[model samples]
Target: MFDLEQYLDMFLDESKEHLENLNRNLLKLEEDHSIETVNEIFRIAHTLKGMSSTMGFEKIATLTHKMENVLDDIRAGKLKITTAIIDLLFEGLDILDEFVKNIEAEGKESDRSIDNIINNLCNLNDVETTDSEKDSSSQLQDDFQYVTSIAQKAKDQGINCYEINVKLEESCILKAARAFLVFKAVEQNGEIIYSNPSTEDIEDENFSDNFNIIALTKLKKEDFKEKILAISEIKDVTIKDFDKDSINLDQVKNLTVNTGNKIQQNNEQNIESKNDQSESKQRKGKTSKTVRVDIDRLDNLMNLVSELIIVKTRLEDIDTDLKGQNMNEAIEYLERITTSLHDAVTKVRMVPIERVFNRFPRMVRDLSKELNKEINLIMEGEETEVDRTVIDEIGDPLIHLLRNSIDHGIETPEVRKSLGKSEVGTTKLIAYPDGNNVVIEVCDDGSGLNIEKIKKKALEKNIITKEQAEIMDDKEAAKLIFAPGFSTADKISDISGRGVGLDVVKTKIEALGGTVEIESEKNKGSKFIIRLPLTLAIIQALLVTVEDEKYAIPLNNIKEITSISTDNIRIVEGKEIVLYRGKTLPLINLGNVLDVERKSENNSKEIIVVIVKKGDKDLGLIVDNLIGQQEIVIKSLGKYLSGLSFIAGATILGNGSVALIIDTNSLFQREWYS
Candidate 1:
């Protein structure tokens, strides 16, 4: 028997991708009402319906069929697209997305109330309720004529025609697998001539607790029943010999006409067959070829490459000691190969940020309707690639950020008109590569951040001291929005003003070794700039020793390395500071901050300072030694060391010792508290 569970993961992945395409195409159809877009949607809907039916998901199959009818009518010029239809289609897509999620979690689509939507779809498209719902008798009627003819021919050849009805237990978990076993059992004793819901539908689990099959077999009826009963989870099985004499051709033709199965209609079949062939070719031409790989497999491959690099690094250390030319050359070759392999693995783990961006258009549309505002969302550089790990964690934070923009940043139409700006507010999400990082900027052309209001809220919430609030500049006050429980809204709604979102965004971003900053103009707008590393698995880092222990600082955060005399360091109000290139930079002693015991303090004549940039500002990190830069793979410190302050992760060095990766941004956070 075929194991349907083995293919469940593949089905869920493909269905999600197809559902995403449907949403994208439907959004396009709503915007342009183009024939080409409608055709693409029809093709996708048809494929989805076929897949769902084969998988035995009746709800998904029925709903997509209804949607297919409407698309069919629209493409045929029998109906026109309207706001109601667009809303209905979007509603269907949302339910479908939810259904897929449920399937992923529970291995079956959870029961959801879809009758109202299905009814609306049927009423809009002029399809009978029963026809769209796939009543078993009506569904069986579509194949009655064909089955009768085949059964008559079998009867003439001295073959017994049997109708097998299988009722599985209600608690059966793997219904599809069980149904496949039934088919296997039937085919072993006889040939399956026809089935009520079709073999594809049975395999897909489109039916409820029971399915029917008609077979021509030479075995005794008792023997066939015993074969099916041996399978597990079967509630009961009923076998009856089908009598061809009782099947009236006229009645079969009438039932066929009543059932609106397009394939049964004589002239429509030819036309539909031609259309199917044409669409098959079109789909073949337009389909984007891709495959899904298991993430665990990729992670295993990355670990292997990391091990190879560690071995190479060990060999390099030996080469320096032994001074063998041949060994040095071999090590050089190994280095080149490992570098290429690292690049290849990183590329494989890269995915376009568009995957996260695609869902926002639909969200913005719904929010605009709910808030009674006109807002246009513009996106740019959506094709920028980021590490898969980053892509997965960044989505919720970005969603919270966007929701904050719509709720707090954008003003209403009347307010915008009064302010001499366009009535429609604009929110733009743009991403691009900068140095070794990816920068995402979310900006809104609406009422900008109110610095005084934010400061007041910050003070009221006890997030900032009154003295600090009084001395803060506009930029400093705006940053207070990220402080815990800081919201300027007078009232809380479902959308925002809960005082919970931005803090989570800040924490999550910082956890990923990224930083976020806010810039605002009084009447113009506000922009939230988020900077994230390109990849998290492996990085170019500058290794430094604090006291006796070593740490790795990501090279992307370092601006420059400078040597300053101990006399050059200035003490201002008991805080260590240094003036570098016309800017006063605060200095943080790595040894003291991480609680490492120092051999001595400020005893050396020369001090090594590593300048790290956070946004437009710089901080000098005082270190004892500057180890050379190297490419290292980051490894999580696991749960025991998870909450270690200012430490991002740990990596293995050539000496087989673990060096904790420092999160430079967290150092700034520590100083803010101090």
Candidate 2:
């Protein structure tokens, strides 16, 4: 029996890659109707068809086969590339994706969308202005596979064509290992001319227990089978002698080169094919390019480097004490090495913002159509780099902010015309480095924000008292729009305002030690500026002590820790309000929050208040004492301890004790009652 798992994974992977490339090429075909893009699109569809059929995903294979034919029409110049055709192609991709996801989730194909896309594809392909042209097209389709007329001269000269099928047991632990054993057995018999699953997948263990192979074996079929089954964990095997055209046809090359010889062989073969040569040239032509990496690896690497950075900072601190002494030379040398290491390691973790930006184009286009508005989205500062940990959490928040901008910020076409603004709305997404953080701004030129509507909504929710709403600062009220389940829409649209409010976006960003601030005008548009740290793996934190307990507050949130006179701490509204910078700041006694003892009888000049701000809201964190600031590696509280209310994450300091990093937003909420 065949091992189905490898084949299924191969099916899923090839389908996804094909879908991505199909989308990219479809986008390319729109701008430039070059023969290259059409051919590229055709190749992707062809691969998808083959993989789907082999995996027994008949619906996917059938639909993609029709899609491939239509693309062939484009490539052969029978059909011109148009937006309608592009839309059809995207529709096909979406259907295929939906089916692939169904297989992933439900372990079976989804037929709901397959028939609809296939019929549309058939109609699109079958269209003709006249009967003669349709006949001419049908004749060409019959002759489409002509490229198989390959290497007759080389083959008839005693080079026999062979097709080999190898199947492993379903209970096999390593299907790829079995595949490799089969590969070795085949090479011992003759050269493997072609493989159905592709060569890279064989090496990558990207195949099922049962894979088909076509080789030009010098030995007879029985000889090949005997050698393969002799291996341990061997199941069953079959070898067939194939026809002539299949012999010299270049099989799909999907092998990851392991040795220098394999790379050299591929390079030589690449030199022979103009298409291969051109793709290499095109890749080299790109000034800036993108690479896909698994986020988990980046996370782990960032963590290890962050700890090193923390230790380096500690070494620097140690050097500070020895600065003017006999150890100055060694200290200077240490400083140089540490500084260089910091720069290099930090660069390793700094990925460009383009990783997040590339996902927006399709989103904006679909959203504009959904709203029946003409909206253009423009992005800038794609080269801005942030720490990898920060990049992972930034995507959803940015998307939510963009969605909010479209739903609430931009006015309808008629409203914009009535407001004397351009009928088409334009939004700008800007990201750039600011101080030690990256600021992402989503600014729209829609009808700004309806402040009066927001005030009324706030009053209804009882989030604010009517008197507070009457005196609420416009800037403060602007931030309220991000509150939980809040929306100013009179009637909910299909896109947003289904009670999945911007509060989730705010909460997510804040959880990453970032801040989301709202800025808006009444009619011009609104700008949601999200400031995120360059890297969350490590941060400059204020190490403070309340009683005997130690904690870290992000240095970004602290303006300064002002030592207040006990006289300045006056009671207001039955709460201890400290006067700082000429304003009353609600005080948070860290000793109380941590439930620790406060040993202080003399309050004359002993206490410290760290002023922290989130958006426009500020709070004074009163700790029993301020332990000196230090750079610390932030670690999560694992899965079980994540919901620890006021704690953001825990970090291990140099002396091996752990300190809980203060949650900036949570502390802000804590101050609401303090």
Q: Give the winner by lDDT.
A: 1
Q: What are the per-residue Cα lDDT tens digits for candidate 2 across 365-424?
A: 778888888888899999999987777678888888788788767888999999898888
Which residue window of length 10 is worst by lDDT in model 1?
A: 254-263
Estimate the TM-score of every prediction. 0.76, 0.73
Flag regions of model 2 displaced more than 4 Å: 1-21, 27-36, 50-59, 100-113, 128-134, 137-294, 306-346, 497-500, 599-602, 671-674
Count of steric clashes across candidates, in order:
5, 2
Q: CA lDDT of each candidate?
A: 0.81, 0.72
How does residue 39 of candidate 2 score in lDDT? 69
lDDT of 1: 0.81
Error of 2 at 440 (Å): 1.5
Candidate 2 clashing pairs, residues 3+ apart or interchain: 200-254, 200-255
CA lDDT, candidate 2, residue 79 = 72
For all predictions, the C-alpha RMSD in Å is: 9.1, 9.1
lDDT of 1 by residue, 1-674 (tens): 66678778888988988988998998898899987788788778877886877677888888888897787667544577889888999999998899889999998988998899999997877643334345645544545755676566666766677978899999998888898899889865556755656544565577788877777676788999999999999999999989656555343422211112221231233222457557756777776565679999999999999999988877877746676888888989999999999999999999999999998998898898999988899999999999999999998888888887888888889999999999999999999999888999989987788888888888888888999988888887777788777778798888885234888998898888799988888779888899998888888999999877999999988999998888888888788887778878888888888899866765888899999988777888889899889988899989998998888899999889889998888777764323
